[model samples]
Target: MSRRKKTSPAEDVVDLIALLPWYVGVILALAGYLLLHRIAIAPLPSALGPGALGNAMVGTMGRGLATAGQYIVPIFCLAGAAISAWRRHARRSLMDNVARSDGPDILDDMSWREFEILVGEGFRLQGYQVAENFEAGPDDGIDLTLRKNGEKYLVQCKQWRAFKVGVPVVRELYGVMAAEGAAGGFVVTSGRFTPEAEAFASGRNLRLLDGPQLHRLLKQARGSSSAKPAADIRATEQASNAAPQAAKTAAPSCPRCAQPMVRRTARKGVNAGQEFWGCSSYPRCRGTA
Candidate 1:
């Protein structure tokens, strides 16, 4: 995965803190309205008959109590909501950190049990009911089973890095899906897949989420409750990977610089079927192949 600066959970908490003032303002507004209403409704007789002064004094005291309640109640409500929002943000931030960290570098930082916990939390955030370290039965490659929408999904998570996932891994997942009659399967890895491995997965009812894809998933989970445009993220990743091929095809060769010439397969009228190769150094080298 391409390296990027990490976002901390403490930073997330700080963001939530910035929104607290708006919540406080809303609560204060409601409290002010209730306090005004209580004061307006407190009884005061137009004609000051005997004992009327005493009754008016008592009514003032009742209004004071009501005003205090108005202020205190809304303060409590705003505080509770702010706390809940902050906690949710913190949880999501921590999950994002786990998903984006370089697996090989961080693997040594966590014990096996902690690694399992992180994986389980990731699935749970995606609304899956996960069974961690599930037994591997014969022909079953599942390390975790997650059920959602009444369909069971067998998942195999590989924490391995510095390696590429290959065809046999996919083949085992296929066998497990067949044996358990799972609706579909997901293979999540902190590393990438070999081209052959990706080819093997294409026709099967399986989903492969590689390291970058996994980071994107965690980022989406951290998003607010709204649909996001996934196209941009996919496009960016594709463009980054395609840059070398694009560069090779666009430039002419410079013997000193070792850059290839711009080449085009079609150049002129009907029969001009191909075009390629002119040295970037041109007159100096006059090289063509």
Candidate 2:
């Protein structure tokens, strides 16, 4: 397939507008054409003095520009609306693919841009308004911005082949979240996080999702009821805030080292489909419950 070409300044404006609802672009297109057409056709005042010559010339220039812009601006807006409609369709198609798939392996084969789109679609299915990052910049670390319950949340996606996300990645997201005053943040990977990364995220309102967790989240979201009211998101936040404490009180201790165990699902071997508690100090202590 052919790759998309680099966008020009005018195309960039169209894309930025495309990020809004598709109908909004259509409305802007209509409004822009009408306003510019009015300006283009307005009658020029008769020059009464020598100084009025410059004003007439300026008005003539304005009308000339407006004459062309009446068409040009609306074309740009309409193009944006077309792009917005295409993206909405793509997102829905992406979600449908995931819903039909059997496992998370489908995610591993996708390009980074496709992965980001999939992630954004997954969030949208969960009732969040998701905005994608189309360009790179200093704060472009955020792959997706999600809004629900009038609260902002940032997300950073790692489609890493290395299969292990570390503390520094989580730390950077936390710093950005703090700087931006986001309600929370999520670090999602098509792989697993290092123990230190998980430790740092605890109680920070930063949810970390490794491969399996993300798969389950998307699957559940697809199966769940359509986007709930804003109050549902708030209730989810309350439940998430209370989860750590509940886990602390309820988790079983490791049989070998006495450390707390984390609930984990078996991915291979005789117990491939089972859920069990495994030692948090894994690799060092191979205890299970």
Candidate 3:
């Protein structure tokens, strides 16, 4: 069997307009100038049978459109280049910060924009190229769009500190995931999630990242984004495995420790051989179902 070749990050992303050869935009601006100059020097269409007044109107309208194009085309060219440059710089800076950060704890202190940038960096670390959306409002239903291995995933970052993220947030993301045909969806919060939210996400193409998991991912991202000459394959693998505990979501948690519970049987009592849920921590936490 043949193995599939991996695409370099540089090969994964290309904006046709933004990455246009410098000569393209220069030629467009040059065309705009020639358009305006042509109108100023050339006579109106000799074939048009319009009388003197109609011809004057036609010439004025033609010149007006050319005048507007002379400004609009160059402005659009400049804007695309500017946006592409800004995105490149932002990604570089975000990766730099990721390598230097102690943990995701800093996420709590960051503004929404910074959090969004941090999230983009996190995905980029996982071999994804992220397209960010800054509107925190309820429009578009997606905050970050990520593509990896020819699959699209949507991510929403909720920095809500005081609330246990609820089911509606996850449900809403799932709904948009269906509409957008995303391979999977993730809702990340710098806080805990409600039991209902976890229940809703289980057994589906959804992953919920609580504060602790986010912390682990950031540490993983730091290694991946480091100045090291080569990729940290081990760190990325570890982080990907820990990103979402899909199996644990279906398992019951220990009531006392609030940690995942393990199944066990009573060893020496009348209840011997009877299976029951026990705390994974054992004697340290005697919690049971």
Best by TM-score: 2
Question: Candidate 1: lDDT of 19?
Answer: 40
Runs off by more than 4 Å, candidate 1:
1-96, 99-113, 134-139, 225-289
Q: Give the TM-score of candidate 3.
A: 0.58
Window of ten residues with lowest summed lDDT in model 1: 1-10
Q: Residue 236 of model 3: what lDDT?
A: 82
Per-residue accuracy of model 2 over 160-228 as CA lDDT, tens digit each? 756699999999999989999999999988888999999999988999988788878887786674445
Q: What lDDT is reached at residue 13 by model 1?
A: 38
Candidate 3, poorest ten consecutive residues by summed lDDT: 1-10
Local lDDT at 65 for model 3: 80
Residue-by-residue lDDT tens digits, candidate 1, 181-279: 899988877778989879988988999978777666665664522234576677888999899888766665555546565444546778377675656
Pairs of residues at least 3 apart in sequence or in different chains that clash in candidate 1: 251-261, 251-262, 252-260, 252-261, 252-262, 253-260, 253-261, 253-280
Give the TM-score of each candidate: 0.41, 0.72, 0.58
Tens-digit lDDT string for candidate 3 (1-289): 0113435432222233355544565666567677776775666665655467787787878877876766666666665556556666775676566556777566677666666667777787788978765322454557788999999999988887778999998999999999989999889888889999999999999999987788778777767456354556767877788767665445698889899888888997899989889999988999998
Candidate 3: give the clashing pairs.
none
